[model samples]
Target: MSARTFLRIAVSNTLVKNIARYVMMMLLALLLFGIILLATGKDPFQSYRDMFGATFGSAYGFSEVLVAMIPMLITALAVALPSRVGLINVGGEGQLYIGAAFATWGALTFKDQPAWVLLPLMALLGMIGGALWAFIPGYLKSIGLVNETITTLLMNSIAPKIVGFLIFGFWHSPMDTVKTENFVSAARLPTFFNTRVHLGFVIALVLLALFWIIMKYTRWGLEMRAIGGNPQAARRNGIPLKGYLIVIMCLGGAIAGLAGMSHVSGFYGVLILNFSMGLGFMGFLICWLAGGDPIGIFLMSFVVAIITTGGNFLQLTQGLPYAVINILLALALFVVLASPKFFEGKKA
Candidate 1:
């Protein structure tokens, strides 16, 4: 066979393999969901119908899903960026909490300030707070050979506690609630179309585009990819391994921090104890599902947002459990991880 013929055959085979893998993943998820429904004595098809209707049936539902996607997109980028440097950033949860805490503090401190002055300061402080939280693990890994995965995960637990302390102790409102005072009107994020969808959605999109450019075109991105692919080789090529690790981890934390800020300023308008609600872990899953691709992450974040939003609908309208959504996400991750053959075909 000619070289051209061989290339064509190889490409076709790879495409076939990817299609098979995706089909199998979907089938497995559906099967598992059906089994769960059977165990619960619920009609799987009816439950699915209600879920779809709730999330995508109305403009308000769709807008709420988009609102949820804003944070997921930013936080997923946090995980994706660090992954490119061969680092696992499980600290997004903690980073997000700390970021929001800082942003809230900034807002409360400068309550009399104008919107233009306070909002940017809140965002900057939030990023710094998240970066500092993430820096702890990065510093440990760089200096002491500590596992970042463990450190980052531990930080997640610590972060909410710190936020709780602030709300329950220092920043607690006089109304006897476990939440801080609402942000000043000037500090709240502006919305569009009189919907819950805020400027944060636009920011997430712009960041996604910027990240795509950095990952595809920049020398730093090339170096990060090289490091992720082969740390020893990257070091041999003089990629400044320690510095890159620290910087990338910080960058990831900063993005997550921005998510926390956006959540507070745009959605809640206040810092609360459970503001994060496992978004960091969800972001990690989104990164895995997207295989750390920026565009893939952006799309998958919306998919996840739909699942979560629809799952809530299922619970309220169909009497199905919300945990079903988590099961589906886990199944999808399991299928992807187990299908090494799918990835191998792509390499061919």
Candidate 2:
């Protein structure tokens, strides 16, 4: 075959294989969740039915899922961006915290400013906060021979405490309510429906297109793919390995920062330590389940968002414990992680 034809075939084959693998992983996860429910003396099918009804059966319920989608989707983007450069940033939680902290401070600091200036400025601060958090570990990996995983994870532990400190020390609102004060209207994301869902959903969708273009069409994206796929080869080909690494880490951090900002400004409007609540981990899971395709990330995030919505319904409507939802998710990720090895048999 001609070179162009061969390239097309190769890309097509990769897409098909990834899709098949994703489907198998999802099926296995469902089976595992079912097994867990059985062991717990509950009806798996009934629980799943209840969950499904919450996400699809009612407008109010479905809308809540959309509201939840903003942060999870953004966090997934954060993790996926780092993975593009072959780094495991398990510190998404920390980056998220710092981002939210900066965003809250920015909005409050400039509450008197117009939305056009204040909003973008806060978002900028958030991205910068996230990048700064990621940059330290990226630097260590690039020059100091330190392990990125350990440094990143350590940061995660420190970030929440910082948030708590701010809450009790300086951020405690002057208002009667105990929580942080509501953010200025300038910082809030505009919503579409009367529901809590906001424009961050639009931002996530726009980002998918932007991600594809940046990764495939831009010089920077090519460098990231090169380093991620084969750093040694990239270096041999005269790519600036350190430059690419820094750029990739910064982009990843910035995206994650935006995630924290989205959660606070768009959803919570305050810097709550509970603002994280495992969202960083959820983002990591979404990236894995998406097979690193942006569109796939969007779709998988929506599904998980639905599952979360369903989990809430199970607790509220059916008197099921909320922990059951997490148990199901853990089961799902475990099954998925095991499937590639199980399906490694040679095709006939």
What lDDT does each candidate get? 0.84, 0.79
- Give the per-residue lDDT of model 2 (tens digit) for 1-348: 489986895688666786677667666777788887788677878877888876888887888988878887888888877788788877788888888888889988999998889878888999999999989989998885888889888988888888888877888788623357888888897777688888778887787779878887898788778888888899999999887777777777888888888888888877765668888878887777665667767777777787677788778765778877876666666766665443232111
Pick by TM-score: which candidate is best?
Answer: 1
Listed per model in order, the count of residue pairs whose N, CA or C atoms clash below 3 Å is 0, 0
Per-residue lDDT of model 1, residues 100-143, tens digit only = 99999998999999999998999999899999999989988877
Alpha carbon lDDT at 224, candidate 1: 81
TM-score for each candidate, following the candidate numbering: 0.88, 0.87
Worst 10-residue lDDT window, candidate 1: 339-348
Reference-based lDDT, residue 336, model 2: 60
Return the clash pairs for model 1, or none. none
